[model samples]
Target: TFHSFSLILSVGDIGYYDDAGQFYIVERMKDSFKCMGRQVLPTDIEAVLLSHADVAEAAVAGVPHDQYNEVAKAFVVLKPASQNKAIRATENDLQDFVAGI
Candidate 1:
């Protein structure tokens, strides 16, 4: 005698595969938030932040804003080598970087 079982699960993760059959996790579906009626992906912002040489790690999340309903806020950790550097990054610099991208 044999028994069969069926199972279903929803992980809420977004992913894609490359041409070479390499799998990549883009972001969590639930992690996306809206701002000004536009859905914003935290991973997209994180990618921009991580592009900077000074940024070692970055996390982005939605925060309440008086306008636009919500806005993206970034938490960044600087590279150890950058900490002792005379040239330091400022808020404007990060903002400008994101804006440029």
Candidate 2:
């Protein structure tokens, strides 16, 4: 479909602006997962995971699901404070946090 070489190219990144007017590329169009008959953007879930004070880093990937075809599996690195014995952060607690959002 190309007659001549063109310098313009599309990177397929999806971006958005927040309330502060900050431009951020949340996810790449190719990276979106199909779940519940809809597209689930990893960055959207990552943003919510990062909102938690205990989570220092977060990553989401598509995993096989029986009903939805695919689901988001999150990997998180907790902050130093949360690692302390005084602060108890359970797997269920983190799951509930994401589910609440």
* Winning model by TM-score: 1
For each candidate, what is the lDDT? 0.73, 0.72
TM-scores, all candidates, are 0.65, 0.65
Show model 2 residue runs off by greater than 4 Å. 1-29, 82-85
**Candidate 1: segments with Cα more than 4 A from true spot:** 1-29, 81-85
Residues 1-101, model 1: lDDT tens digits: 11132222133444555656554444555778789999998889999999998888887777778788778888787776644687767779999999999
Candidate 1 clash pair list: none
Q: Which ten residues in a row are the worst by lDDT in model 2?
A: 1-10
Error of 1 at 60 (Å): 0.5
lDDT of 1: 0.73
